[model samples]
Target chain A: MEIRSMRFKANASAKLADAGLQRNLRKAKGKFVDTRAVAIKEIDDFEGTRRAARDLRDRVLKDLDLWLERFETQATARGATVLWARDGAEICRHVVDIARRHGVKKATKSKSMLSEEAGLNQALAAAGVEPVETDLGEYILQINDNEPPSHIIAPVMHKNVEQVADLFAKTHHKPRKTDIPQLTREAREVLRSHFLTADMGISGGNFLVAETGSVALVTNEGNGRMVTTLPKVHVVITGIEKVIPTLEDLSLLMRLLPRSATGQSISNYFSVLTGVKQPDESDGPEHLYFVLVDNGRADVVGSEYHEMLRCIRCGACMNHCPVYQSIGGHAYGWVYPGPMGSILTPLYAGIENAVDLPNAATLCGQCSAVCPVLIPLPELMRKLREEQVERKLRPLAERLALKAWAWVANRPALYALGTWFAVRYLKWLAGGGDRIRVLAAAPEWTAGRDFPAPQGKTFRELYRQRQP
Target chain B: MRVALFVTCLVDLMRPRIGFAAIELLEAAGCEVVVPEKQTCCGQPAYNSGDRASAAMLAKKTIAEFEPFDYLVAPSGSCADQIRTEYPGLLADDPEWHGRAVALASRVHELTDFLVSVAKIEKIPGAFEGSVTYHDSCAGLRSLGIKDQPRALLARMPGVELKEMTGADECCGFGGTFAVKFGDISTAIAAKKCDNVVATGADAVVAGDLGCLLNIEGKLRRMGDEKTKVLHIAEILAGDA
Candidate 1:
């Protein structure tokens, strides 16, 4: 909810030191990667599927306004109110206004990153309404002092069972459960009462099917079904980019989403709600509303970053990312985390406020390789870096250093002289050892690893001697 | 064929031996190797840092100097990738430079990739007696499709047992400027990489790029595992390890 992306370095340092969080990160890393590998391998033509998914997304994004309008018309025809929000504040205002108008006392929410982006829970609470997170991970975060979800799909992924055990004991006043099923059962039991009593249900749409005017919700838990059906009113808040042309397109994307996100053939529950409960339908909401939040997405649609809009939020990119693997999601210091977060946070939140997010990655390209929609994540981040330079958003020292290096690099003779001196100076710093443990100029580098010393002569000098 | 060796800035300054080793491998494959003295950097630092002007200037300079050679080869995958993949995109708006960049991109290759794919050398230049695990540098693996090239070359060596480490393709976090700016995070990632490398119980960990090798080796030494060797693919393939 808060933009602390400016403190990325400090937050990353703390996360790197947080032993419990590190353990959790390490434990969770293998499952996502290994399972996705297995799931993808099972597909006869996974690359073709990825291409189709990319095309599907790009097609919708190319005519995004047309798709959104079609979705609005279809949804309205099916007796659902479609509201557009320009940004987070408006999204929250729309939801809160709906709640106040309905005299809603409490609302149960499934896992919706857009809601997190809108700070929907805090807004509802401020408006004198209670918001309960029904998804297991989201519920855990809710009970734990309303801590922000560190991960997109797995909200409480930063916490280990031990931490959750302590939190559950402290908050639930129940006996601590060390085993996972018991803990999950405890959470389900706790949320069951709120699910039934809640007058309004809030959800995030995985994909809005324009063909059927459907809001598709994908989740591992049954909460998605309960949240949408067991309430008087249902409000779906999602990004405008979530729209697809047709249900057939949804089918094509569904083949990749769950497999990429959590490596499941299909999630436990996939609900497609067309409209409010008809007279014949006994178990559905009375009121249905769609709140499509543009929130900087419209600006991205036709830009160089339009490829980013194709993301289905499967989070395979982040799951495969090495930086995300090292520092968990919270270190990103935003509602979104990992490679996608690095791009989205800078674009949605001002780049000036979140400069480090773009520069934090090693440009490892693992994210790009794993993305189901095949977003060139590393390239996009590089473009963001270019934008930073264009806007003069980077620090003066870094810009100047690059400028100086470029100047020397352009002149071969000067560059040779500079490098010769650099090698000798570094060799002197190494004190004849094979490594330099303390580099005064780059303390950051020597902080954790020794610098391998130069091999005494530059390659050019060696090459020249070999020639003569 | 006369091949100009783009020795790479890191190989030029940090370890000239990799350059020599690359030259040896290329010559063994029946190619005349030339080191273009005018070359300094591939401008990855500036390009990645978003200084396109500097990156473009260096790219153009590199393109002009290396253009005359029959082929351009580099010891490092990242730099080769910068020239082969990124240069055209970086200079795309300029008609003259973009064409040059495109022409040069096809001619550039990483050392092992050239050795196996282009040179098609059948005999190995060097032999090793112990086990070695390969680290796939990110750019080489993803950008240039360089996974099998180095391994295939190493397979030709005598007594070289390739012990595959878990997540061999995973990043070691040297990411150039990223290692310095986000040192702690880079170290943390490299620490896990070291763990994987050590778990294989190989005598050496080798990679196609010096940047990743340096990071892996630096972290390995800092972790007090001095016996395990960290070598470039050129060194191991050239029997200099």
Candidate 2:
């Protein structure tokens, strides 16, 4: 039932909360930020490009079903089977059926968060197929039997190098050493062998070019290459929202995806595989299939939160978010931790179980500012809060308090009297906003900080003197 | 311009200097400033805490009280943002009140944005010498889009040594109600703010919103490090220049 992991919500004690979920985020934020700056700095018209890209995404999303249908037709025409799935169970069934038909024993995967959303690897494993992760980050988390990913671009962003090394050691049944380079080397060797021997490769598509029916994957390492090209059977599981009407629409995203993600102009490997390689194609998967997973996405369209589908998974939203920057993604208590995750997690899961997700935001609007598609993130999150209220998930106490406030607010006299009490004597009662941190009401505000005493004179009181 | 002051409930009850500073600076700018006495809290607390009924009533009350002015100004970015943004949202269900909400939004301004973009004030006309850093309050920076306005003014001030701190725009953990609801983490983040302030070796810190400043200042004082002082952007601008 826990969509995400529980983290330090509010550590009253400072020391316990200061520990880094992943050392790399702390050690590498400067590098990630700098690389992105350098990339955009090279492109003189990056902002213009971002605007064009945003407009393109807007147009595509405006008629997502149309593009998705076009993509399916185009992809199916190109000799790749495209199956539509309405929910996670359906998506998992499609993937599992593919493996069963192939008699697949080991299914190697690259980084695809949709697969995580569909819980594909576990579904495959439950069906008795060993699903191996080829991406280094995915491989690390997979071997540990741990969570899928913490951040979008960098899956295990919260794990420091030491934890990775230890995970490597435990999974490999070797002695633990907290060395990052050594651990990476170990992962590289272990996953390299799996890449060569895998029966099927299940990769996630960043964008499926509707015109060409080409599945585009942007990866840092070359594993997406191995996962898609090496296996005998290649399957891609992605949300229907990932389709673009044409390559031209994709080109706009190409400029935006890398800079916003990991701060790179382009990822190390950008591979385009069009239908199963031709008869004489040197080396590629022979059986090609794409499972297009809708899974509640259709419900999001034209709704208040339809914009959530515009995410290109840049991780910039998480990088710049104050809450994500501090506690890391895990504390958000969900798979997609930052502002983007807040909206997505609630929608994917029931809003009731994941109620805290909406409250995680400061409503800062920075996530929206940095979003390449310009998704109105904070606004969408607020809309979710509104929905949560309409659904009556909020506690009765809070509901009643708001009603009482509304009643007082409706009566000018009652509100004025309350203001009078606050302006006149609350300072004395609060002892100059002193040691009243723990009070009967507003325990949240008074915790850890004290309020300053209000002056006996309200601004109006002073203004009345001048006029009188 | 005749301006009506919306001194947020927090300032009206806890910190009056912020309200006074806004008045002094507006008066200095040659505007006729008026504080409407019947105005109560802007109802942000109840609203943000998921109490829409109370928030809606307060939003209506706020609109009725300030709709008479040519401009509605506030010293806090968060408050102004709430009035400008949330008020319209609250009154959306009521066609009559929606018009009032829209009217208030059209005239509403956070102090720094209005000061720099409208009143067009430059030169800190006051004397204060020492290194000072700024924390971009969330509402002012993200919601109100006032990032460079205050910083631009601060950089131009005479005798001020401006030192940029890392993550200057990061939230200081004073999310108004959030700070109280999530105190442990609030204090944890506030302690980081204290650390950032100490790192600058700056004599003081300045911000456009008092809510964050108070949280930062309270932690600093409670930690008993008086070397750093907190000031609202208006106080610095209204300096005895």
DockQ, every prediction: 0.91, 0.50
Per-model CA lDDT versus the true structure? 0.91, 0.77
* Reference-based TM-score, model 1: 0.99
CAPRI category for model 1: high
Please identify model 1 stretches exceeding 4 Å from their true place. none
lDDT of 1 by residue, A296-332 (tens): 8999999999999998998898899899988989888
What local lDDT score does residue B163 receive in model 1, on the 0 to 100 scale? 97
> Considering every candidate listed, which one attains the maximal DockQ?
1
The per-residue C-alpha lDDT of model 1 at residue A303 equals: 96
Which of the numbered candidates is closest to the native, going by highest lDDT?
A: 1
